[model samples]
Target: MKFKIPDRRRLLIAASLLLSSAAHADDAARAQAAVTDLGTQLRSALMARVKAEGPVAAINFCHDQAPTIAADVAQKHGLRIGRTGLRTRSPGNAPADWQRVVLADFETQAQAGSAPQTLRYSSSEGLPEGIALRYMQGIATEAPCLACHGQTLAEPVALAIKAHYPEDAATGFREGQLRGAFWVEVSSGN
Candidate 1:
């Protein structure tokens, strides 16, 4: 005896699968957009701070100001934002996945001698297996970025860093080194 599946049942299964995938994709896109917008605002504020103050001051300002900026934006948008940095060596000498990604992108741009810029990424590995995760660009170096993140750290820069973060291990950066990256999280209400 042979058995056959009903055509209506097959169609229903196919439609459900398609709908699920489409929903997942939409959520991911929304998360990406939210993080991208946050990155834009953060960069703008950082640039303005740098222009007003020197590199060391800019770094300090960012350290002081970024949290508030992120919090305000996240609260308004109903999202979460986290920041991390790239350094010559990872904290506790452990490998940092986020740093690795930023470094790779920074190296590619450096090899081509282009100005460093923001990079973005998305993932859906965790969180209900369908929710999208997003991160925004965090370039390692720029012309002005050198004072705080350069081949050789300036005296003032070193002092400032020590003052702010005594246990900070973020140093020994080259012109195009990946010094840090930002991670922003968003929830797609889908």
Candidate 2:
């Protein structure tokens, strides 16, 4: 049978679909790149703090810096930014919106005996129309980190941690265990 010519309406619909998909892909890529850049800066700042002060200081610095850096990057890119720490127990069965990408990377790095430096992507479960990106780095199990994040918190560090976070659960870490995960979330409106 002879093939019929395509109509204008059908051609337009196909073109629209192609463009929408391409736009989504582009948005995801751009969001990833923005987060990567911000993460690099945050890492550099945290490392500097660690070198200047100590691991506890670095953790404190990161705690303050992560959100600021993420917000700045998101604002610059005209996107929303958010982050969450991975839990010891997978929240897969929990009602809360758990971030699995960061947790997986942290677990992989913990098993490999290396600091995690990978950034992964995922989409929101509640808002499936958006894209999410995350990055995890090993918090060096140094003496300072052990103070608060260590199995036995040092007096001074413990006091400081208590003062800052009275109900903190980010502790009881070993010298080489994954202390916690750092994350960045971006919505692509896809």
Candidate 3:
């Protein structure tokens, strides 16, 4: 099929739109991979600590190494990635303004019968510096996560959490519920 453009400007615009769409799709794929890699590394490290030392040691590892792990993954993926929620264990993990909106929407979607793991959001934002591709994937509370984030935590776990995060509010979660989200932002020149 032959397609005709009325003007060069219109043809350029069409090409730009197609290229932008392709770039967004690529960004989404990379963002998802980064989230998956970060989650896998974190879970593996936490499990190893729990097996070798204990739950408390796992908590300590999260406090000490989670940020480092996230940083490494972000660097490897050429984007910024982290976990966030309304109720955060660490202050550093608190959702930013835009993320708060997305998290709230994810919660609403979950309440409306969407599975937690099926909730995701992505958008492109124009920033002063450049355009940013933002993405979020919901994290479900699993049975294994109950060791630290369940309604009733063991004394040791509670103590360890308090020692690490005095303002913790990331508990009281049930299995299959929305725990939080993994967020990724890819910007121009990143």
Per lDDT, the best of the predicted structures is 3
Which of the two, 2 or 3, has more TM-score?
3
Badly placed stretches (over 4 Å) of model 2 are 1-6, 88-119, 124-153, 172-190
In the range 1-190, model 1's lDDT, one tens digit per residue, is 8797799999999998897678667655665565666677877887887788776877678667766787877776666665565443223323346546655765566567654454455554454443355544545555666666566777887888778766666666666655555555555553
lDDT tens readout by residue for model 2, 66-125: 667777887886665443444331222121244455566666766786753343444433
- Whole-structure CA lDDT of model 3: 0.92
Pairs that collide in candidate 3 are none
Instruction: Give the Å shift of residue 178 in candidate 1.
Output: 3.3
Please give the ranking of all candidate structures by TM-score, highest first, separated by commas: 3, 1, 2
Models ranked on lDDT: 3, 1, 2
Each model's lDDT comes to 0.62, 0.57, 0.92
**Root-mean-square deviation per candidate:** 4.7, 5.8, 3.2
Output the number of the TM-score-best candidate: 3
| Residue-level lDDT for 95 in candidate 2 | 15
Ten-residue region with minimum lDDT total, candidate 3: 123-132
User: TM-score for model 2?
Assistant: 0.60
